[model samples]
Target: MPDAQTPQLAFHNVSFAFDETPVLRNVSFELSSGETLIVLGAAGSGKTVLLKTALGLLRPTQGRVVLFGADVTAGSEREWFDIRSRIGVLFQEGGLFDSLDVADNVAYPLRNQPLRQCPEEQVLPKVEESLKFVDLGHTLDKYPSELSGGMRRRVGIARAIVTQPELMLYDSPTAGLDPITANIIVALITKGRDVRNATTVMVTHRFQDGEILAGFRYDTAAGGLGLTPDHRGDTQTRFLVLREGEMVFLGTQAELEASQDSYVSKFVPHT
Candidate 1:
């Protein structure tokens, strides 16, 4: 078990580029166990790239990426595969395979990841429980094409959480969903954080996603989100804003809202 001092995830001066062009520049942040980081930015602002780099899906051009106190900046693919087994990721648009049914999709990580030795017999039951957590227990037999967009997103969440990873990364989880569906998804994300005490990094375009994360805690007894008392000021959640591949803001909701930077202010969502 990792000691309490180690951060669940950290990016140290990380930068990434695509050929001659840069997509992320000198971006750095750290998320401790059970802490939440909300990433916000306009289109093409490197939000997705940041998550991908942290997950080792993309190699950085400079600096180090650390997971569970280990440096993985230049880790080999085989090493990354083992490290990835301990982290869960929900890629943009659910990223589910249309060829696989819900159960199989959720079971993919368990069966494929080198560190997860989940026995074949235990896969289905674990998959079912994960789906149930996302309120889609009955959709096990369903295919990705059969479900609505929102339901598919939930399935993605189910798949991401099935391995009970210590770190979870969500990229544009509610990008195309309606407000109601989006709120439900964020609520489920909050529930996952509270129930599992997992470290979370969510990249989203919606400021409301960050608000809900900072203002509420999942109430297991009530089976839903409950307003966190004293949430207006102090909170465990923090927000980071990116501008043209650079981190322009990193602070709490209050600090982020108060930021006067023209680029940062654009994400505050004028109510």
Candidate 2:
């Protein structure tokens, strides 16, 4: 087992390409346990590729990916099974099974590879608890098609978190939703982070998403997000901006806001 000091995820001078076309170039970053990284970029900025590479879905053409303190850039698919089981991912658009009900979807990890040994008796309760965690406890029987877009996204979140993963990767969780719904999704994400103390990496194009992750925390007593500017150090949120497959900036929200670079400043919302 890796020592506690190891970064939960690290990409060292990583680059990825497809058929001679480069998508990411010499990208690198580290996310410690309980810290949150918000990746911002315009469409096709390699944000999704970066997230997938971190998850070992795509091998790097050059460089290394360290997970839990072990190098896994060349790790085989079978070898990645255990590593992946320890992480949770919420893909774009709530990637739920249209054929399955919410309960079945959330219970999938427990009954599948790497976690397949989980007792049958524990599956339902685990599913229920995960759903409740996302405020979707009553949607167990609902299909993805039956739920609203926002609710489906909640189910996606519940599924991502059902494993109580040590790492959570969210790919554009708020993409395609109304502003109100988007905020709600982000609040749930905040609640999950504060409640589980899970390390998180979220990829989004919206600057507000990064702002919320940096400036707010889940208030357990109030059951919602609360301003925690005084606890900024404790929050540990950072922003990473990507442009055309390259990392253009990596810093705190304040630093991001203060950036003078034209490209980086474009992602910073103007008051």
Candidate 3:
């Protein structure tokens, strides 16, 4: 298991709010390089906010967000852009531009950028290669309106990783899909992380992907929360539960399974 202190991404006492209405309350966590940590919580749990902060797109109202050994909360615009270039983010909706073709969408991040350092002829090939990586090679010329939801999501993923980002942030990657499609998306997400050895953070509600983190969450008698076993023999995963702008629990999946706290108990699905 990765050590807790080996943080590629760290949030220390981070807090955020909109118009003085707090959304996240002193939340903190760390993920080592090449580790995939899935963030879980009920609706409106600030998962997206956390993801954005890590991406350097949003500033935390309190504390620090450290990336690549630099406090992103302190970087200038150019420095921030440079740090952002090293990471890929696959949004829940896939975030592909409707006006551009699939290949162009993949190339969007590289366009006119001083960082790419590649000539014009090379860009199309790189775009083609990214599409191939996402298994959408044949759809390079297609438009977003012409693709299925799954296909569009794949394209968005292609664009995210096209820059070869060192970290990846995915929001609800498997939402709005069938069982088989969801599994495929999960496989793609995991495969990219493993291949790149990138620090991965997934904002998802599903327990299937949550099994990868190395901890648990607190349970309440209401059964909304529970623990996952430490010795389940699968990868260890941590679970964090947030409610009403407060962090209620942060533990391994094993620990969450054993808790009986009312707030956590209500979430255990009833058969």
Candidate 4:
């Protein structure tokens, strides 16, 4: 368990509704530094609303969202601007601008800062570094329209990590992609956790993705990324199962597999 100090993200008895429609009901969880929390649920399961609440984009009707130990549920938009800088979000879609090239899109966040704070020279190098990290360095000049869906998603990831945020939120990153391409995106996300040590909360219905992320470790010895056979007990990855706007199960991969809950068993993929 994480110490009693400060959690990177927390939701306490959070509930949200749209008019008479309840979306999230009494959802609560905490993400510590360098941990990855995989949220598994079907469509319309309130996953995206949870992400929005974490980012302070949406306020909960019942409970508050605490970010880095600070309750930002009641914060104004102006106050959220600074808080947002410390977090990164990858939308379900690529969310790239059609008019901008890859490099510019990656640099968009940095450019929003004061010119005196981020000079032109500093901006380009950072953009180049971020793109290189995602293996998209060669696509710097390519427009979103000119790239494939997988490539566009990679570009979106490059843009998200450009500022080196301490927290990352991904909404169905692997949805609607071929298995091979989805694996590539999963690899990139793992890199963020293993290399950058960024705390992450990902929403996905793919059981394979959750398993790969929780079971695999980056093998630096191969000079490339690959899965490790032995499951390290020290893994920081965890699974959170959401059903009907409520948490049904939260545990390690082994615990999840051992669970007798029919709903959880049905969702667990067969090896």
The lDDT per prediction is 0.92, 0.91, 0.74, 0.84
lDDT, residue 253, candidate 4: 83
- lDDT of candidate model 2 versus the reference: 0.91
Worst 10 residues of 3 by lDDT: 216-225
**Where is model 1 more than 4 Å wrong at Cα?**
232-235
* TM-scores vs. true structure, each candidate: 0.97, 0.97, 0.84, 0.93
- Ordering by TM-score: 1, 2, 4, 3
Per-residue CA lDDT of model 2 for 151-252, tens digit only, reads: 988999999988889999999999999999999999988888999899999999999987888889998888788889674556899999999999999999
Q: Which is superior by lDDT, 1 or 3?
A: 1
Candidate 1 at residue 29, lDDT? 88
lDDT by residue (tens digit), candidate 4, 1-271: 3354579999999999989899899999888888889998888888888888888878899997888778888999877888888888888888899999998999988887432257778989999999988888898888999998888888889888888888999988999999999999988887877777789888998978877778776665664566555663554888888888888889888888888998877778767
Tens-digit per-residue lDDT, 84-173, candidate 1 = 998988988999999999999999998999999999999999999999999999998889999999999999999999999999999999
Query: What root-mean-square deviation over C-alphas does model 2 reach?
Result: 1.2
Instruction: State the number of backbone clashes in model 2.
Output: 0
Q: Write the per-residue lDDT of candidate 3 for residues 1-271, one digit (tens) a residue.
A: 3354557788899888898888878988777676666676777878888888788777889989988766778777788777777788888888888999998899988884456766778888888888887789999888999998888888888898888887888988878877777766766676666556667788877766565333322233432223336433233335666666566777666566666877654444534
The candidate that wins on lDDT is 1
After superposing all C-alphas onto the true structure, candidate 4 shows an RMSD in angstroms of: 2.5
